[model samples]
Target: MTYTAMKTLSVDYRLERWTGTAWVTFKMSSNNATNTNLLNATSDWTVMPGYYYRVTSIHTAYDGSTTETSKHVSGTVLF
Candidate 1:
């Protein structure tokens, strides 16, 4: 018997700021990996005070025949 497998993983990050009425995306980043279980990414931004900011992350993984996706949003923070 023989088996073959192919795996792919990707993550996308977005930085949002509350613009008094709605949340707007200001910065974005993407990372991808193959046949790996761990992925790491980083981003930096200069934020002004007196505003609320948040981060949204989208993660996706695929293994030969199946694909899964999840999304997460962080709590707002004042800067």
Candidate 2:
């Protein structure tokens, strides 16, 4: 997924089981007058049976000079 913003920026993601573990992949890039940014990530998430999973806003921001912020979340599913 790709996001482009002149003001506020946001992203949404979902990782579902394929074979063994669900692999979540994401990337973000921007070219603005103020700065240029690049980011990438990959993870294998496992979900058990008879359970639910929910993950909220994972955010990342990078300026040409530095990585500003990054966040992640993981939740269990309940049947």
Candidate 3:
């Protein structure tokens, strides 16, 4: 089975993945005032017939500039 998740964040903000004890960072940019930007993360897994995996954490940042905004959400996966 495969697991896929997508997240969108505004200008100056970013998303980072946790590698057990540390974080791998990814950056995003927005050039339009009204455009929605997105960030995506994916993972693959194989399990028993009744198994599942979960997304544990999401990290968000907003670059304290006066011209941009940001938002975030986190959840689990069921298959």
lDDT, candidates in the order shown: 0.83, 0.41, 0.35
lDDT of 3: 0.35
In model 2, the worst 10-residue window by lDDT is 27-36
Ranking by lDDT: 1, 2, 3
- Model 1 Cα lDDT, one tens digit per residue, 39-75: 7778888888898999999988888788889999999
- 1-79, model 2: which lDDT tens digit per residue? 2243223233344543223365333323232222223334444555566545555445544433433444565664453
Question: How far does residue 67 in candidate 2 sit from its true spot (Å)?
Answer: 9.2
Query: TM-score of every model?
Result: 0.87, 0.31, 0.26
Show model 3 residue runs off by greater than 4 Å: 1-36, 48-53, 64-79
Q: Candidate 3: give its CA RMSD in angstroms.
A: 11.1
Across 1-79, the per-residue lDDT of candidate 3 in tens digits comes to 0122213232333344444566444333332222233444444434333323333333332333332333543443334
Tell me, by lDDT, which candidate is best: 1
Clashes of 3: 0
Worst lDDT window (10 residues) for model 1?
1-10
Error of model 3, residue 10, in angstroms: 12
